[model samples]
Target chain A: MEKIPILRMGDFLLVTIQVDMHDRLAMALQDDLTQKISETSARGVLIDISSLEIVDSFIGRMLGNIAAMSRVLDAQTVVVGMRPAVAITLVELGMSLPGVRTALNVDAGMELLRESLNGHEGIRHGSNF
Target chain B: MAVISSETIPVTSEPDIVFVRRRVRETAAQIGLSLVDQTKVVTAASELARNTLIYGGGGAMQLESLNGPRLGVRLTFSDNGPGIPDIQLALRDGFTTGSGLGLGLGGTKRLVNEFAIESKVGQGTKIIITRWK
Candidate 1:
């Protein structure tokens, strides 16, 4: 019944994960994010997880899946505000999250998303020329 | 050493896994584990709890506070579902029989100070892990 809010910022979707997410909620988020990307024609996604203290393999996989799905939907994803402990535990859990970009905070994440989107636009323009 | 306190919580669904991780974090912190250690134990608990629900067909986790020369928290997950046919293979990374990425058992083992698992074809499986402070 509880749902995570997905905020739209320009061409990007911002998700700030403040609660300890259950498995179903995580899966729902993945589905919602991909749908949002398609519906809004968003070019980027930013996931803020500074408030999340623990990230197991399941959540880690969800994050990875969101990134991969976003890529296919013509969007780039940047995860921000990962706690040091969570980062260490995730790596030890053997989830490198290869497809997901990460930043130290929301500001940096937004910047990364902007750069990624702009870079893609540049490539698109270059191809036309 | 003796257990200072203990409690058992059922893991029948997805939300229960989140509850197990929260309880494990609180127990580990209560035992004065460092931030990193608490995170490690809680992360391990999350993975194992999911395994119980998904693979073992639901079970329970017993959380215990240990007292001795070293203070610590111990968690035991028991299930009576269809048992793992090959624990050695199951413990190997990337060897999942399901749709999972197959990091649960092997990665959980690395996050704790002590880990033990036992299973039989029809008898189900039990895993006990401990982290010392």
Candidate 2:
């Protein structure tokens, strides 16, 4: 019914989450992104979460799942624009989101995605928290 | 200590959890909680609401704006499900009876200024958490 739009920009897919997602919506997103990655053969995914005010463990797990799914499909995912408060809450929630690469903003996220696709293995933003 | 205002939000479905988060955010902000405090309490509400739906087999959250001692937001989630068998284990991080990160109870406690829980094996569970501004 309701869906977050996924935009294709050349070799990357851009997802900007602007809603306070319910659990079902979050799950739908994970499935949709995974399918899109396989179909489009995109090299990277850059999700902009600057609009999200909070991130619980469920949403955190969804992001981690999206990253894991894309990775298996041979695509890189860089989540960018996390608010400072969300980052703080996520860490305190005991989910460091290991293996889910993060960046400061969309520009940095695109750059990180580019670097990741350029054979620069282990291109993480130090600690995601 | 004393509630200035209160209401109960039913957590019967997935959308209800989002509603709970929104209501909690409004109450948190209404009580003049800092931006970061609002985020923390709202996040805590999300986790607990999900727990109510999935584990508690549906429940309700009593939202309260307090005025005694200090202005704050309080949320009390109650469910008449099987209830938590072991509070300590449930509160322990990395231990989940359900398919979750096991951060619901413990992590939620950390986000608030005060936390309390009561459960009966054959009865239900009730958790009350408060965040002061």
Give the TM-scores of the predictions, in the order they appear: 0.96, 0.95
RMSD of 2: 4.6
Give me the runs in candidate 2 sitting further than 4 Å from their true place: A120-129, B101-104
lDDT for B45 in candidate 1 is: 93
Every candidate's lDDT:
0.89, 0.89
lDDT of 2 by residue, A7-26 (tens): 99987999999999998899
- TM-score, first chain, each model: 0.93, 0.91
Query: Candidate 2 residues B1-105, lDDT tens each?
Result: 788999999999998999999999988888899898999999999998888888899999999999989999989999999999999988887778757544647
TM-score between candidate 1 chain A and the true chain A: 0.93
Computed on C-alphas against the true complex, the DockQ of each candidate is 0.75, 0.67
Which of the numbered candidates is closest to the native, going by highest TM-score? 1
Model 2 DockQ reads 0.67
Residue A96 in candidate 1, Cα distance off native in Å: 1.2
On the 0 to 100 scale, the lDDT of residue A48 in model 2 is 94
